[model samples]
Target: MKLRIKEVIKEQGLTVQEVATRIGKSKQSLHGIIEKGNPTIGTLSDIAKAINVPIYRLYEDDNDLSDSPVIICPNCQTQIPIETSIKIKSYNHD
Candidate 1:
């Protein structure tokens, strides 16, 4: 199942309607953009402003793991990467 936007919105304790209103986008339009995972620069900026975070932070945290399998620490809100290739290959997200 896909839930990228849902997860972010949930973390912010906001609803889709609220964010859409903040960004000046219609709910249907926002839903489409979020599901496609391709937001315009203006949309990103709007979302960032609404969420009270930097534009970059709107998508990801401070961690720059690049090509690693990273997981966000639910407790500390830090991104941690599984460094070993074997570990990454064997890790089960479910």
Candidate 2:
């Protein structure tokens, strides 16, 4: 999975150094993790906390899946097909 660490950091108006400081990592180490393309769950969790975003926000939305509607799971960041999403409209009589 492609993690959008850099993009999310940019979106949040934060610099890599700021986030590195928040997560207790050196700027060079953080850059290495970003360039490595695969970080452990613990690392991702730490980054999420530092950036103040759900871990799912760090995932790059799959462009190939854009043709189909999908919903992201907040916990695991797995994409759920829209058809499989439970409908609540029927429960809303109002």
Candidate 3:
């Protein structure tokens, strides 16, 4: 699923570096997440905390989360696209 990390960060007035530091990740690593759309659960959780947003918000589809203008990877310190490599699924065993 596409994540809205960049939009949430911007909405919270957070810089990529700040989010990276808060999440114990390098800017490059975080950038890779933005570009590659693959972040560890721990990283996503930390990002959720840093931005004061729910994890689901990051995966919301209505806001064009994947089409965000930029993303910073803490691993590689690069800015890249937010297209997601994995699809999100909702569990409803009813």
Candidate 4:
């Protein structure tokens, strides 16, 4: 699967160095992983945790996401309409 790590990082206004520090990796190492466009499961998990986003979010393509704000039911997989707003929380990778 194509990982959107770089895009998500940019969208979150986070630098690779920030994420690298959070994940206990060097910036160069993180850049290598991003440049390769593939990371091991453990590395991906660390990145997700570092960024405070659900793992699945990294896999979602912006083009594939609908413009409408809707929540997907976990069990039945139904799309439920909901009022929502894009709120970017301050990154506290402490």
Number of the top candidate by TM-score? Answer: 2
Better of 1 and 3 by TM-score: 3
- How do the predictions measure up, each by TM-score? 0.55, 0.69, 0.61, 0.62
Worst 10 residues of 2 by lDDT: 65-74
lDDT of all predictions: 0.65, 0.82, 0.74, 0.75
Per-residue lDDT for 1-94 in model 4, tens only? 4668888988788999999999999999999998887677678779988888755556555445445555544454345666766988898797
Model 3 ranges off by over 4 Å: 63-94
Q: Report the lDDT tens digits of candidate 2 across residue range 5-88.
A: 999999999999999999999999999999896777788889989989876677787665545666665467578776655656
Q: What TM-score does structure 1 among the candidates reach?
A: 0.55
Q: Tell me the TM-score of model 2.
A: 0.69
Question: What are the per-residue Cα lDDT tens digits for candidate 3 across 14-74?
Answer: 8999999988889998989977888776678789998887665566465453456445455
Off by over 4 Å in 2: 63-94
Query: Regarding lDDT, does 1 or 4 come out ahead?
Result: 4
